[model samples]
Target: MNLSRPLLAAAAALLTLSLAACGSSKATAPGGATAEVTVRIPDPGNSGVLALGKKDGSLDRALAAVHAKVAWTGSAGPFAPAAQELNAGQLDFALGSITSAVTALATKPSFKLFAATDPDPVGEGILVKDGSPITSIQDLVGKKVAVNQGGTGEYLLLQALAKNGIAADQVQRVYLRPDQSAPVFSSGQVDAWATWSSYAVAALADSGAHFLATGPALGSDNYSVWAVRTVFADQHPDITKALYQYLHDGDVRAKADPAAFLNVFTDAGPLAVNGRSKQISVDFGRQNGVLSPIDDTVAARFDKVAAFYAAQKITKSQVDVRPDLLDITKLPGGSR
Candidate 1:
């Protein structure tokens, strides 16, 4: 994830432009700006569930109650690097995978973790076309696989293969964004695609596609957590709390009616999927889809990711994330 200076600058500029689309104005709050809390979610094309919140007004309605506001800036790469955007002031809040956050947090410890979600253990995984000769992770040797840097795809693929006796050098890992991976995997250009959530579901919809392995199989203690830039959290603690509170409420509403939620996603989503989002959303909701505040066990889980990455040498040095984790009180189920 070594971003060049020019590329980093460009990414920051793109994020800034995206934030501008979120709209800003002259206003003052107890902390500072009141116009918008610019947050970035993984922009997995139109099928992204996060986009639904922006379209259906659920996020807005939730924010309005707390006298808070949010401006979504969808980042196109690994959702993990949104933490980098947050640290760079290109984003205020971002949601990411456990592996992505822990790995990125190793380098960007300035990010603060507040809340975490218990993603379906099997929700994310390596997907391959049904008729492929590949059967086990061992078969990945000398095969091309699509993954995203700063995403679970690469991590899962690496761990799954290694466990089955394939080393990193034995396979060809093609790094592609979620959007890019879908069509590539669909066209049979790559042997497999490793991704999660709706994007994974979209790939799965190809009746010919099937799961080869999953995060759980590789001992991935995954969670989708929302984190923010430490400075922003320090300056606007109330606003941060309001955002998470709204998110918790939205989760409750989402669970109560997964189908309805999917409709909003599909209706608002620009991608023409044949009910992929619907199926993924409903099943995901039933997969212990509840969120919990940051606690010791969860924090340890994040620590494990750091250690995992270090052992894998994906990171040059070890990073301590506990110092940056903040326990925000007064969440839906109450904070730890």
Candidate 2:
């Protein structure tokens, strides 16, 4: 179902919170102790990154040094909703894909991207049923493809298709949530599905889908980013720094032991589908410790995304993606 323009407008309204209340803390800790920060994480699909934080005591260890308490919250919906809550001053931190962050910035420019948890954003890709004759972007002409609107999945597909000289009108676009797109794809309702990380891996395993191309093929530096409200960062700079460190540490642990990471995912909750966990375990290894620096590749990818959005008329004006919205140098350790 298409989300009504009015509903989306309302969402934009609720999503807009003033930065005036940004640095104010509701409660102060005793004896000048650091205030506790609540972190809201959208469900990791089958990643188990959240559970790992709890089990490894990484959250505790990271915050302990700063004398701050870490309150963890999770949701199963798209990252946009939780990020909206963060924009509304209900959350201190939130996890989201790079595209989600970009959308959030379009509405609320007060949030700052701090670090990247997943190394490559473009790892996500379009999956077609195995044995399908579709071997390249040109082959997708006149076929139905599913993707989440305004998401990395959609963005990557747009870029890939454009790079291959495929006209937008040549293919039918079916906007579906990542979860819904999978079943539709498996049922042959759509010729291909664009998805990322856990869901993409799950589709490959369950449906025997062949990869058209991954995000990296569209652009080398496509990667997800972790960001917090600007006020939260300004008020609690130490806590923000600690959180970045914690994410970096988690990446280290994930690299050293992926099976251990899968166990964490399984223990936290059942995978949306079985056998998907195994695939995720193998994929996470390739992504581990790959989150250190933002290079020219990332900047170039952002430019590509902005240009695509402009061409699609997704924005009324050109998006200036530097200084105002992206200040990579401000990240922990002054950017890599």
Candidate 3:
């Protein structure tokens, strides 16, 4: 664990910069306590509450209750790289799926799940052309199916196969990121594309593609997850409480008027879809981003995801997600 002088100096400089970015504000808390009220959260420039909160200033306005402000950082998309950033103390908070979180855990990431949203299968599933012969899970046998490696796409695909008594190896798996898989799927290079969220919405909307097997139909336990740097959560419990409150309230508003909260619920990618696809994404957004504490039910779902990753040999070993979950109920905004 020894580092050269240059490396040590660089690390020290980075830490100093991070601290300066999150430097204490002059605001006083309820008990006349001077709170260090700056949270360094990611801005993936994509959809979701974080982006909406940032754009609308609701995230900052909400954090103001705790005398906190947000220091928006770089993108934390794709989860795995975000975990590395969290471990390196370069980021404070990020959003990810249960599948991403489980895989990130096996790498001994320095992040913890603090809040989560309910499972919404609206736009999660494998998409095939409208007239394709792949009508069911059974049709995937020996066919090339594109999926993001170690992500929701792969996890849902695997779960669907397992649920239908189909062997994982029976289907030809083509691992590709969303951007890369889009063209491949469009050109008929792949029989079906396993995806979730915006990508799924876009595919179905743009090409008249239909769900060959939906996430819920195939029994998906996917959940939207919020993760924070372990050190940040440990040091600023109040800040976490404020954040959870904001998310909860945001979800409430989003659900109440999904059309208005469309920007908050999803990014522009899916919103760009016209007609039924746009409506589908909006409907999915209604109850999708509801944030709640990582309670027993959430933990059980995450644990199941971990077990699946281990069984699929995606991880070296099974990771226990319970210990990494912060009991938000103990925080100030948790009860609501």
Candidate 4:
């Protein structure tokens, strides 16, 4: 293959960065040069750190301990796309939902889940117009429910329906993003909406909106996972561990100062109804416990999620979440 000098240089630089990023933990890269940690951000994935980073620079201080700075990669949301970008090798580390990772892996993407957070199970919910007389999950049967296809919203709805004795095939699902879901839901375009995080909670506060059920109310303990390409993890175990610590620190700081980190999560989008920042913070803390190493409980939870996705046909391919979880032993925290 023929290559211009500039093209060759860029290729070489990429190779060097990748090697440095995935290499064993050291004061520097294989060549003694440190690589910055590239994080796909502005989503729920890294919102805690992003928010804390903005308010007091706590995330920065954590990053500095490993001598790595954060290089913002993609400025997108809902977590699904960011995970896709990471799997494609266009980005480095990513924040993703367990459902998103499972769906992607069912298709055989070279991805891995490094760490996990179980955000308040109730953080996600099935929403309806306030005072509409539909008070429980059973009411959603035959009703049009708005959800993000191939995301948490779908399975969360599925689980809710099953618990209420409403079959999955009974409800009409309107595939809508968070931005679209809120407005359409308010305008009566859909009978209900299912979503997660501060966005889901914000929608519930709408004068015309109320929750029929939440993740917990529906028997869900789904998790938000931190992931990287397997190839990347194989090469940079130390850097991978560093990232988990930094994010865990962010979660800790946010919990200690809940009022301080509210806007960070809300920054993903607007809140038509003014949100309760402190409550959101505490709830977020409750939903997502300390960032921890993946334990038997984590693996078991993921297995259930995989089986659920397969049953729901969210992923047409065979699903096995076990292979996708990357175990890092030397990390400061013993979670994974």
Best candidate, TM-score = 3
Task: List lDDT for all candidates, in order.
Answer: 0.70, 0.65, 0.79, 0.70
TM-score of each: 0.78, 0.80, 0.83, 0.81
lDDT score of model 3?
0.79
- Choose 3 or 4, whichever is better by TM-score: 3
lDDT, candidate 3, 222-295, per-residue tens = 88888888877766666787787787887887777666644544444643445776587778777475788888
Q: Per-residue lDDT of 126-151 in model 2, one digit per residue for the tens?
A: 78999999999789899999988777
Q: Judged by lDDT against the true structure, how good is candidate 1? A: 0.70
**Which regions of candidate 4 fall more than 4 Å away from where they truly are?**
1-22, 25-47, 264-287, 331-336
The superposed Cα distance between candidate 3 and the true structure at residue 74, in angstroms, equals 2.1
| TM value for model 4 | 0.81
Please state the error at residue 253 of candidate 3 in Å: 1.0
Model 1, 167-278: lDDT tens digits are 7889898988777888888888999888886577666764468788877777666678878777666655666776677677667866776665454445544555446646
TM-score of 3: 0.83
Please give the distance, in angstroms, between residue 95's alpha carbon in candidate 1 and its true position after superposition: 1.0
Residue pairs with colliding backbones in model 1 are 130-208
Give the clash count for each candidate: 1, 3, 1, 13
Candidate 1: regions farther than 4 A off = 1-58, 75-77, 265-273, 330-336
- How close is each model in CA RMSD to the real structure? 10.8, 10.8, 7.7, 6.8
- Candidate number that wins on TM-score, 2 or 3: 3
